[model samples]
Each structure stands twice: as structure tokens, then as C-alpha cells.
Target: MYTLILISTMTNLSEIRALVLPYYEDVALICAIITALPVLVGIILYLSKNHISKPSTPKDAEALVEYKKYFTEKELEKLEVPYVQRIENNIERDVIEEAADFLKSSEQVLIICGESGIGKTKLAIEISIKINESKELTGNFKFKGNCLFANLRHYKNPKDIEEKLNAKLSEKTVLIFDDYQYNMEVFNEIKNKALRRNSKLIITTRPIFVKALKEKIGEVSIRKIKLGRMDINGILKDLEDGDLKKVERISEGNPAIALLALDYIREDPDRNAKEVFQGIRTSKDFFDKIIKDFQKEYGEDFIEFLAEGELTGGVANIPQEYEKTMIEMEKSGHIAKHESKYHLTPDVLSEYLINREFFSGTILKHSFEELARADNGTYILEMLNSIMKIKDDREIYRKAAAKLLEIVDQLEPNAEQKKKRIKTGIMVYDGFGSLNLVTEKLKEFWTDYDILQDGKDLLDLGIFLIKISKPYEARKCLEKAEEIFSKNHDKVGISSTSHSLGIIYQQQGNYEEAVKKYNQSLEMKEELGDKSGIAITLYQLGNIHYSQGNYEEAVKKYNQSLEMNKKPGDKSGIAKTLHQLGMIHHDKGNYEEAVKKYNQSLEIKEELGDKSGIAITLHQLGNIHYSQGNYEEAVKKYNQSLKIKEELGDKSGIAKTLHQLDRIKKDMDRLKEKMGEENFEKAYQKIESNNK
Candidate 1:
């Protein structure tokens, strides 16, 4: 039996040991001595090979056949990454993260649902990348065969699904099904196959699919995530003023449409709103070009209609001659009508549709005049609402919107009017969609920034910039803002500035300054009955102390935050504070206490759907395994953390994993050397030098 095993296998140490153990007692001392030298020498040879051998890391990866079998040369080249590509995803960062957490730890099955253009594709990609990281980190990234990324709408039927899954389904692999909303039975049958075979199954769809699943498979069979539109805040903050204007001019906030719009902006950097709108259509036809396409379709009618409709009837109304063209345009997705009027579809679909009028509209000057002359607060609000919809010349909207706010505020004839204007201004601010407005407004606070108001504008701009993470500018803005607030006796603005400055310092690792600013903010909030503000400041102080390694002091500050009269979000803040305490315990080598604190944080994070926070805890738990010399378990935890990081595109966490992986490899080499290798010393030296 041993001989048969030996003939079939290159080497089976356990079989050899089993065969030899039975014969050891019968051997003569001289015979044993004579045989021992050769056996010892063979053991040394085997150990030496295991200890010194490296994994299949290629010199020029392009030469690697194994890699070529599964990936394109481009994929294998391991594209140079400068930093995490900043993706302003349409879906909320938190929702995607929560779904990812379940995908990493659960049974490799998930369903993500959202409306079209709501970022289902992005979320799927995020989850897949993360799982890929997990496979890579654990030294198990073999895809067995290939990866099949498909839009399920075109490919339905259980048989087709099986054929595709069989085409690539291996022991270790993942499949991403995008736009999988059209067929419910095909999806379930595919999911069932992956489950039976124990492989990863990811499905992306619109919300309609969830209903189909519920009706066909019953509640017990459905496990899914629902997605929403791009938060205006996320979109705005992601773009610079120039890009923000471009996005507004093109996509608005729809992820798919936004991409289409961005491409056009790249091609025609100088195109105006009317010119852009002219080209914005989804159908690929004569109407695709801005100036010529629509003209060919509608002839002189399209032009005379635009001249009469936009120039004469005002944007609030449309001319009668273009009414039929407008319906056709709407059906083709060239023009969008919301409240009995026409506006250009977002920039994404603009290339497919033509809106030469919208693309050519004089946005910077003329758009502002139309807005200013528009009737009461409600009418102005309606016009402001249309700013994001118009797309293609966003700077026009920003300057115009800011001016309108200033103009309306100045015209405040009574107390009620002032309140209405302020409310309308905030609506415009929020509706302009994102941080570019805040950043633009705050530009007046720059070294050479010029705004007529000496201090009020700067103070408001400072607060706005702080919310958007423009720290460098925030500091300058806030400093001037504080001086102005002090001059005008604006106690509220002063307090706010103090609070914001403290957060800036704390984030930069300046604990001393952070604490000082918090103290002043705390005093002001207290006098003003700002209980919520007090709690938030206390929490910031706690984080600063924690970063400085002051565990006890952090706990004290956290307790103060807890003592204040705050709201639901504060509960998550408290959980974070507890998490910081867990780290301190983990660092101090109190494994049990650390685990307890971590478990507590995990519960809160789960409840809160805080995926980033959960990933952090997973990373911390991995340390416990390394501390105990349980390398396999340690690698497992690290792999789990890597999966979450990948889904979230958390770059810092990826870097940390790479740094720690060197240790795991070295440890494995050391164990092999200790077995019997005479060249163990040389192997250790090679690994050490390689690490350096």
C-alpha cells in the first residue's frame, strides 16, 4: 500500500512515516545507524527545498502561462495605482458597505436592487473587488477557469445560467450578474447551483426584480439590498467647481447619465448650456449631434420653435409649434418634462439626444437675469430647482444662485420676508447639489478672495467648507470668519468657528490645539443651550485624546458626550468611543477585554449599518491571532478585513495588509527550515533581506 502510494505521489511524508513506524522496533542498532545517515540527509534536502522555495512570482509577469490562462496581459500587469481612485458613487457609501459585510461573511449569496442609474453596477464591482482581495490575501486566488460578467436581461433561462456557471465555476471564484432584473426563475436557479457547489453568487438588479422574487420564490428565498439615488452632497463634494459645473450641465445626479455627460464635456470643453442640451439625447439617431442632427429631423421647424419657445416664451413656457416635437423628444429622452414644461435630459443621455438650444443658452448672464426677474420666493425657488436639471454650464448656476441669495436677502422688506428668503436660499444651496457651491462661496475667504461683505459671507463660507473637508481653506476662512463674527457681535458664528477649528486640529493629530478649541466651543454651546452641540464637541475631544494614546482621558471625555442631551446619531458616536477603548485594551495585551469591547462595537455597527466601522474591528481582531502565533487564523481574519476594505475601496487598509503579509510568509519559511534543513540560516537571511 505504501509503495503504491509512493508510486502515485511525488512525496507523501505521512505515508512514509506510517510505513516506517511499524519497522522501527525490529531493526538492529548497527543497521539503524547505517540507515539513519541517508534518511537524515534526505530529510535535510526536503526541508531545505521547502524553506528556500518562493511562490510562483514571475520576473516578467507577461511570461507567466498560469496568469495568461485566466487574465489578459493588461490585467496581469497589475496596473500602477497612485491612490484610491476617488469614485463619487450614486449609492450611499453606507448602504453598499452593509451589503458588502454580509457578502464577505455570509454564505456567498446576495441580491442588490435599485432603480436604473442608481449605482447597482458600482456596488457589484465594489463587492467583487473586495472578495478578490480576500482570495489574494489568503493565497487562494485561483479562479479555476474564468470570470463571467454579464447583463442578465439578455441572458435568461436556467439552462443558459448553468452553461455560463459551468463555463467558469471552480473551487474558488466569483460571478457578478449585472442588470439581473428581467428573469426571476433564472436568477434563483443560478443562485441554487452556486449554493450547491459552494461558490460566490452576486446579483444586481432594479427594484422591480425584488417584487418578482417575492412573488415567485416566497419571502424565505429572498435576500437582497435596495439602493437609492446619488446624494446631492456626495456628488457635489466629489467635483471641483469646474467639474461640478460640468456635471450639472450634463448628468445631474444619475450615475449612468453622468458618465455620458462627462465624455461630452471632455470632448467639448467650451460648449455652452444650449449647445450641450442640443446634443443631449439617449437614442442614437439624427438627433445625436447638437447643431445638425435635430435640424435634419425637424428642418426649419426645430429652429423657429427654439427661437419662439426659449427666447420668446421664456423657459417657464414652451411655444405651440414645438409641442409635438417636444413629445417626440421626450419619448426619445432628449427632453425631459417634469411640471408641464421642457428641460434637457441630464448630460449622460445628451449625446444620444440633441438640445442645441439648451447647450447654447447663455447661462452665466442670461440665466441669472431670468432667475432674478422671476416672481415671488416660490417662483425663484422653482427656477433654482431647475438649475441641476439644465446641466452643462454649472458655474453659471453657482454664481447666479449665490447672487440670487444675496439679492433676495438684501431685499428683505420685513421679518417674514427675511425668513422666507433665508429658507429659499438654503433650498437653492441644497438644490445646487453638492459641495462645489460651498467651496465656491467660501472662495471669497481665500488670501486674495474678494467679496463685498467684510465678514458675514466669510463666516458662512467657512462653516460650509468645514462640512465638506476643505480643511486648508477652512482654516483661513474660519480665521477671517471669526474676526468678522467678533466685530459684528455674532456670538453664534464665533461658537461655531471654535467648534469647527477644534475638529480640524484633532483630525491633523494636534491634540493640544484640538482640546483648546473644544473647550471654547463647549463654553459657548453651554451658554446658548446647545446641548447637541456640546455632546458632539465632547466626542471630538475624546477622539483627540484617543489618538494621542490617552485611553483614560478619552473615556472621560466620551462619558461627558454621553451625559449631554443628544440624538440618535450620537449613539453611533458613543459606539465609536467604545471602539477606541477596545483598541487601547488590545494594545495593552488584554485580549479578553479587547474582544468584549470589540463585540460591543460590532453589535452597534451592525445595527447602524456602519460597514467601515465593522471593517476596522475585523482588522483589530486579526491582531489577536498574530499575537497567539496562530498564523492560519490570523491570515483568515486579515483576509476577512481585506474583503471589506476591497468592497469599500479602502486603500489605507489594503496597504496595511500588504505590510503585514511579509511577516506571514517569513514565518512559514522559518517553520519549514526548523524541520531539518541545514541551510535554514541562509533561507532566513534571504527572507529578511527581501523584506527590507
Candidate 2:
């Protein structure tokens, strides 16, 4: 009976399995189809999107051919010869890399903005090349298209831009509008079409147009890259040192102007870069246009005020009545606002404005009192210095000197005012005026005021004269100051005058006299327990020792100064002492020691926000690397140094760093020739990879 029951159960189970098996199979089939359906649909969509048919008609083909030709012409075939990569910050990332990333992202428009002649157009072209090469793009949306460029300045009417751009707008293309005029209506039309077609656009424009462009674009996806001055050391390798300095001064990082200056130099080899730049017809025309526009927009009064502001180191104290005008100027990128003051843009424009006002006699029209009231007469002095630097005409200098002398004569006999007048008189004589005339007038003028009354005034005047390279004049002032201070029993004043005399003698290459004076100051500082003053005197003594090639003596003095500075927590003094020690080591060919010292100094400078010091240290580090034949490392250090120097507007430092870079380039070229191209390339790649 049990066997029969088992057999019956097995048969019933088998029947139940047969019934469920078919349904299970159907469910599995449905699951498979559901899983595969989305993928199949994606494939279909991709194929359809990518494999659209082209126009087959003859007219369409011809039109397509014409468009291709136009685009080919518009495309930047390659970067300009001797292109210098421009970095926006201390980071190694360049503008081209940043712009390429923007293109790869969802941003539909990239605007390159900067001052005129700051290479905005060149930057745009570089970005175009980067996009075409597809080198930096690593994103979901990759650009695979023709890069086309157009200068909007060539297109007079908005309608014409619309018509020309219509043929170029597509998913597989990018259009760059160079020198965009911020035509909102035309941009809107093009942008709307570009959005629908999924194309990107780039605009190169002056910073003045950026605000209008943004306001016009509204909510459209956009990005902006601002170009600044780049290291043109490589480009200027052929220039003489004098010419290089002249170009650095005038170009102010504008490569186009630098090149133009170079061309002028080539044309008239006798004329220097400054002379060529001053006489450039194009620059004159450009300034003429700017002056005319400014006069038309804001009137002659505004221009005069701007000239005054320019004279005062680009700062202008805006009155309430002209506040609105200043706001407009700031928005237009003609000026920058800083704490209730407006600074003129491009700084170079200051030269033009001052020259214009001076030649027009607009500057002379102001009362001496009015001029003196402005920044304690700094504007008048700055105007004179600027005119002296730009103009070679002795007649112009004489006229300016006469005006300065007149202003000096009107100043009150107050100690501070008298010092200023005397300084101005000395500056006039030093620059262009007759020394005897200025001296006799100063002598007569000083007789009216008792110089012995204020030792501080005479001391200050002595220091000022020292700075202006009039060591003899400075010595006389210092001697008188010392006498007055001794009579008044002013120990601090006497010590300072002694130190000033040391600096004067030191600068004149009289190490023995400098040492004697420095010893006198040092003794007084030690007696008064003036730790900072002692450190400073010791540092000056170290400099004297260094100049005289007394390495051991210099090191001893520097170490003593360093210890004193540390005790006082004078970070600046400490950094400077460390830097001096590093220089000694560098001169001694102790590169390792030099680097260590520089690094120590660099740490403090970085902490203190001492950009100038940091630049100096970085350059020193580059020198060490160069001496050690670490060319790649040397270049990295140099670039780091150059970036800081450029930011600080240390034109001389920039030129020096560039000179080093040029040297490195020449060295590398020689190496390449010696090692053969293939071997050099392999070695360079190895070094680069290792650095990465």
C-alpha cells in the first residue's frame, strides 16, 4: 500500500510541473525583452543623430563647398609663431587649457576680455587651436567640429553678421567673434540658433564691453577668461638689454605693442624703444581717438580731472558732483574703483593724459595752491618726472622746471613744506634744470627759514637726495642734520644721520668711509638699545663687506643682523638677511647652501605676503638650479619667479628673469643639437613625466 501511494504522489507532482513550466518560461522572456529594450532604443537614437544624410542637390553641394572654404579660411591654421603661453594665476594651468575646459563643458559662450593690445584676439585663436586639436577636452561632450573665426569689426551691420554666421552655425562647428562690439540684437539671434543647433561660440572683446555683453546675454550659459601680461622673454631674446628695458617699460605686457616697438626699432636702429614708442603714429592716432571720445562724452573738465588723477599715480579724489561720471567710467573699464577713489585703467594711459594736458597748458592753468592742496603737491612733481622721462626736448624740460620752481617758491616755510620744495628743486636740477640756478635759488630760499630748527627735516631731505643719487648733496644735508641733532641732543636723529651718511658713502663705492660711518651709527644704536636700528646698520655693513668681496666678514655681519632681527621678530629684516646670506653662498658656488638659505627666506616671505621678496628668492632658486644643470627644474623655478614679478609690476625683475629664461632656451637648444633631436625629445619627455 505505501509503494502505491508514492507512485501516485510522483505522478501528480510531474503534472503540476508541466503546467507551471510554460508560464515561467513566458515570464523570463518578458524580463529579457524589458532589459534589452532601452539599450536598443539608445543605439537607434545615436545612429539617427550621427548618421543624418547630407544635401544631394548640386546647389546644396556648392553652397556646402563655399561654406567649407570660408570656414577653412576662418580657422586658425596654427598658433602664431613664437607663441608664449599665458597663465592666469600662479597655477601652471594656462588660459588655453581653461578655455578648452569651458568648451567641453555646457558653457555655450566663452568671452576673452582684457585691455586693448593685451592679446585677447591671440588668446581666442589659441583656444580655437586647442579645441580643434581636442587635446585638453576630457568630458562627456567632446568637440568634433571645425573652428571658425570672424572679426565683428569687419562686419558693419548686424544683419550682415547674421547672414554670414547663419551658414556657419551647426552642431559640428564653433564660431569665434573677434573684437565683438556687444551688439545685443545680433548676438541674441545667433545665440538662439546656436543653442538649438548645440554649437558653441567664443567672443574676444575689450573689458569695456564685457558688462554690456553679459547684460545682453541674460541667462545664457557663458564663461569669461581674462588675459593678462605674459612673459615675453622668449620673444624678446633678440633685443639688446637697453632696448629690452625700454620695451618692458612701454609695452607693460602688451605683446602687440612690444612687437610694434620692435618693428620701429628695426626701422630706425638709432632710435630706442622709448623714443620709438613715443613717436609711434599708430599710438598717437589711438590716443587721439580716445581723447576725442572722452572729450565728447564727458567734456574737457573731466579729461583735465583725469589727467590730474593720472599724475597722482592713477588715483583721483572724485567730488560728489562727478560721482556718477566716475561710476560710468568704472563700468566702461576706463577706470577702477578702490575705496572711494578711482584709478585709471591700463596705467599707460596716464602717460598720454599727462602729456596731453602738459602740452595743452591745461596743467599749467591750475593755481599753485590748488595743485599743492592735491596730495601735498605730489601731482605736480609726478607730472614733471613723467614729462622728463617721455620728452627729450630740453625746452620742454626747462618749461616744466620753471613751473616747478614757481610752485616751490609759493610753498610756505613750514618744515615739511620746505623739505618738499627743496626736494623738488633738487629733482629739477638733477633731471634737466641748471644746477647752479637751482642751488643758488635753494640757498637763497633756505636763508629765509632756519634749517637748524628741525634736524628731522634736514635728515629726511638727506635721505631723499641719497635716493635720487646725489650723494654729495645728501652728505651736506646729513652733516648739517648731524650738527643740529647734536646741538639738540637728539641721539636717535644723530644715529639716523650717521646711518644715512654710511649709505651715501657705500653707494659711492667708498667702503672705508661707509664702514667708519656705519661703526659710528652702530655704536650709537647699541648704546640706545635700538635693536632694529642695530640690525639695519649691521645689514648695511654686511652689504658693504659683500661689495668689497669680504665674504667671511659679510657672513659674520649678516649672521649678527639675522640674530638681532629674530630677537625683535622683524620678519622682513630676517628675510632680507637670509636672502643676503643666500647671495653670498651663490657667489661662492655653494649652490646647496644657497638653496637652503633661499628656501628659508622664501618661507618667511610667503608668510609675510612679501611678493617682491618671494620673486627674488624664486629667481635665486632658479639660478641655483641652472648652475646645477637641472634645466627643467630651473625653468619651473624661473616661471614661478616670473609670475610673481609680473604681478608685482617689477619690470626690471621680469626682464632679469626673462633674460635667464632666454639663456636657458639657448642652452637647451645647444643640448638638443648635441644630443640629437630624438634623444633630446626622449630625455625631455622623461624629465617631464618624472616631474608630473
Candidate 3:
């Protein structure tokens, strides 16, 4: 019985094990699938990101190995630095990609241009390296050129460069002419031979010197990349946690300069932004070093020619004595050849050299002496004309005027240069707002010289004298001018002199005399078809009429003046007319019309940067607001007018604005008492809410 029970229990245990075995297998399979799913997904993602694929052929493996060879491990490491790695705004990246694509598409010449210290060289190196490493590339790629200034001097001509480049460009080579000064000879030789379909030439240079290449090669097939301030922001990224912005602000969009400035700031944390910028601007170290090196190799005279050559045009007109020096300097990267001329590298260096020469007075004195001797007058006149063109500071104009006067004093009494010199001096003094000095200088010359007998000269002097409020003295000169004009039958001269006399009479309150002279001038101007002169006479007549309360006549005259000025695109004349029209409307109590006219005048004046005119219009606008019971708005406009007046040093305008402000304050106090503080605010709220 016990044997039978043990056999039965064994049978039951064996059946239980058989039933659970299948379920155990299912649980293990499910666990294994859950564990493998993440690993499979991760592998797929990695492959997708890296574009990894198994090589199907031996050539594929070889190509991969070759692509990796373009950048050595050491070079790859260098790119990790922010200076190399950081690319701001993708400007450099887009350029690099465009260049690479061009090179691949068989574009022969790629010119990269920018101001110096703007990272042209680095960008070029980056481009070359990227091209070499491209997977699509096919050839024994070689990027070889002597971009060093020292090495560049050895290349006397394009033939010398081509000879050296010939071997490297055997299998799709890139010849890098870093900061190349392309002359017609060099460009022609390379364009024919080295710049073939199989090989490419990459040139880096400043923007100022690229005109020559463009002129020679024609803009058809040339590919150009301009590195700009936006590109230099790459340095900002590499700046990491330091004062990158400070360095960038100091650099003024120059990468190399920013790097130098960063190093400078790191050396002494105490240095401020102003000091750093000043140091960068004032530092002649870059050019000084180059000059010193050249001086040692060549001589002091060679450097002097380099200095003078840059100042006065270029190497073409330089004395034959410095021909070899010019060539050497061009090779040495101190100067670049463009447009059949030689310009200094890094334009700012040229500016610094010019300023240095100007202050030294040697070159300036020599030029002055030459002008005095030649009596050609054009050069000196051009120099003075440039001062006016640029609208230089009063101090600069004063100094220039003084120097020109000294030159004039040294010139021959009846020399043409002396005449031009006086004319230039008067122009400069007039611009400087020192017309009294002009009067003094002209009077001094007139007392000593016999130039006043000339009708045109007397008329010019008379008009200028009247402008400076010397109407009494101007009358004598005008009478003389009229006499000469009458004898010569110069209708144009008579009209101009008569108009000037009318101005004097009008200012002296002789309304009838002024009207008669103006009408006479207008008749002659009409006969001569001088639209400009007619417009001037009409404006004067308008002013006289307005002063005498003839509003309708004034409006008509101003409208005619406006039409004449519009034909000539005389923005200032249009603004003046609009301003006068606004004044007339204001006097007539047409506040809305007056405001529109004043605003139109203000827009034109602001566009022209006519600060004085802007202030006047703002003042008028303030008056309109004050009349409209908008005291707060009036104060705001008055303040704006006053601020501009202070900036312009217009004492009269300032006084007027201040008086308006005082009157507005008193009006506000009275209004406050009459309406109470709350009521006054409510009234201001309504005015403010009104869109005028």
C-alpha cells in the first residue's frame, strides 16, 4: 500500500512540473525582448546621426582613410579653440561652403576680401582644410603657397610664383596667394597658366585693393567673399566667460585686433575699454615693425618713399629712384598694387601714416611751397575743398585756414595761387562761422592788393559782408559792383548785386527801396531765365510782405519760391518755404494747418540733419500746442527744441525756448488756480488723448 502511494505522488509532481515549464519560457522571452529593444533603437539612432554605413568595396574604405588624412590629429585639435572653432552668424560657414562648392565646380580664382585684422587668412586656411577633407573630393589634394611676408618678397613676379606652384598643383592643387597685390602682369600670367581648370588660386586682400583685380579679370567668372564685422563675432563665442563683449567693442569688428586686445586685457585687468581702444587705434607697432624690418633690409629712403608714395596717389607717379623699393614693398605686403596704382595694406595704417605726415608739417610745408611755386592753385584749392566737403571741425578748419593764409602770404602778389588762396580762406571762414575773420583777411588783402577793382570780386565780397551784418560796408562794394556790371553790360552780375543790395535795404527797414531793388533784380533774373535767382528774389519779397502784414502776398510769393526750389531739388529751400508758410498760418490762427506745415518742414530738416532748422520748427510746433491749451505737450516740445538749440550752441534759440517754458509754467500755475489740480490733469488727459 505505501509503495503504491509514493508512485502516485511522484506521478502528480511530474505532471505539475510539465504544466509550469511552458509559462516560465514565455516570461523569459518577454524579459529578453524588453532589454533588447532600447539597444536596437539606440544603434539605429547613432547610425542615423553619424550617417554610418558599412563599406561595400575596398575603394570606399580607402576614400574614408584619405579624407581623414586631410586634417592631422594636431590640426583637428587646434580647431577646438574658440578662435578656430567659433563661427559667429554662420557668415564664415556660408563663405567656406560657397568657396568649397566653387572649387569643386572648377572655379579658378576665389578672392577673399576684408579690412585688415578681419580674419581673411584664417578663413582661407579654414576653406583650404575643409576642401581637402571633403568626401566628394577626388584628386591628390595639395594646398601650398608662401603667404608669409618674408616669402612673398622672394616672388618678384607671377612667373616666380608659378614656377614654385607648378609642382604642388600637379594633382588638383590650390595655390594660396594670401594678401596678394595683383598687377596686370601677375594676374594675366596666372589667369592663363596656373589658374587652369585643374588648379585653383585663392587670394586674400583688403577691400580697397580689389578694384584692380575686378578691372583686369572682369566680373564674369570671379568669386569673391567679403569678411565683415558680423563674421568676426566668432571671437565672441571663444571668449568663453571672459570680457568677450568688452574686447569686441574695443576691436571695432576686427578679429585679429580683438585677439590682440584680449591678450592685452588679460595681462592687466585694470585696463578700461577706452584705454584698450585708444591703444589699438594709436598702436603703430604693426606697421612700425614691418617698416623697421624693411628699413634693415632696404634703407631709410625706401621707407620714406613708402610713406610718401601712399600719401600722394601711388607707385606710378613716384620718383624713379624708388621703383625697386616700390616693388619690394608690394612684395613685402606693406603695399598692394591695384588699378595701376599702389595702396598701403590695411587702409587704417595708411590713414595713420597720413595723419603722422600731416602733423609733422614736413610734407605739408613742401606741398605748400610747391603750390606757391607752381601757382597752379588746383591742388591747394582741392585740399581746401575737401575740408569743406567733409565739414571738418572748427579747430581743423581754423588751422587749415591759417596755414593757407601763410602760404598765400608767401606767394607772389599777383599769383593765381594767392587769388585761389583768398577765395578758399573766405569759404572756410564762412563755414566756420567766423565771417568777421574773413572780412578782416579780405580787407587786409584789399588794402595791399588791387583786386577790389574787379566787379565780380567786389560783388562776392559785398554779398559776404551783407551776410555777416555789415550792410553799410556792403553798400560801397555793391555800388562799385553795379558800376562795373553796368560798364560791362553783365546783366547776370547786375541782378546778383541788385539782389544783395535789396537784402541790405530790407534788413535796414527801408521797405520801399528794398521792394524796388528786388523787383529790378527779379526782372533781370526773369529775362536771363535764372530760376535760382528768381526764387531768391521772390523769397525776399515774401519776407518783406510778411513783415508789412501782407499775408496773402507773402503766401503767393512763398508758393512761387516753393515751385522753383522743387524743380532744383533744393531741400533746404523747400524747408524754408514750408517754415514760412507755417508761420503765416500760425499768425492767421489756423493751428491745424500751421501744425501740418511745421511738421512737414521738420521732416525735411531732420532728413537733411539741419539741426538749426529742426529746432526752429520744433519751437513753432510748441507754439501751436501752447495756443491749443496743451500746456504739458507744449513744455515737451519746448524742451525738445531747447535741447537741440543747446547742442547747436544757438544762444538765441535757447533764450527763446527758455522764455516759452517760463511763460508755459506761469500759464500752468494760473490754469491750476482756475480749474484746480484735478481739473487741470483731466484737461491735459483730453489733450494728450487727442491725436494731433
- lDDT against the true structure, each candidate: 0.53, 0.64, 0.61
lDDT of 3: 0.61
lDDT of 2 by residue, 354-431 (tens): 435544554335643465457556566665554544322223345556766676666666776775676667566545
Clashes of each: 30, 0, 0
Stretches of model 3 off by over 4 angstroms after superposition: 1-357, 360-382, 392-425, 434-451, 606-611, 629-655, 665-692
On the 0 to 100 scale, the lDDT of residue 417 in model 2 is 70
Candidate 1: list runs displaced more than 4 Å: 1-472, 507-510, 563-572, 599-618, 621-654, 661-692
Better of 1 and 2 by TM-score: 2
lDDT of 1 at 523: 93
What range of 10 consecutive residues in model 3 has the weakest lDDT sum? 1-10
lDDT pick, better of 2 and 3: 2
Ranking by TM-score: 3, 2, 1
lDDT string for model 3 (221-290, tens) is 6677766555345655666544866886677566656767777788887898878765665456423433
TM-score of each model, paired residue for residue: 0.36, 0.43, 0.48
1-692, model 1: which lDDT tens digit per residue?
Answer: 00000000001123224434534554454356547766576655565578634322212222101212323343234311121222432223565455545544534445666544556555544444544454321232222222334333333345544554565554344454432332345556665555656454445644433444445433333356655445333544566667665675455455545555666677887887555543543323323334344455556555444433332222445568766776665553355565555654444122221232223442123443453545544345544554434333223445546765655655535554444453444455445433334334432323332332446555555555565557887688778778888888877888888988887887777878888988998898889888778878888887777777888888788777866734535667766767777877888899889889887887676545566677788777777777877666667667767766775556777788766666777776777757556575555455454333
Q: Counting only residues 3 or more apart in sequence or on different chains, how many pairs clash (N, Cα, C under 3 Å) in candidate 1?
A: 30
Q: For candidate 3, list the clashing residue pairs, or say none.
A: none
Tell me, by TM-score, which candidate is best: 3
Model 1 global lDDT (CA atoms, 0 to 1) = 0.53
So what's the TM-score on candidate 3? 0.48
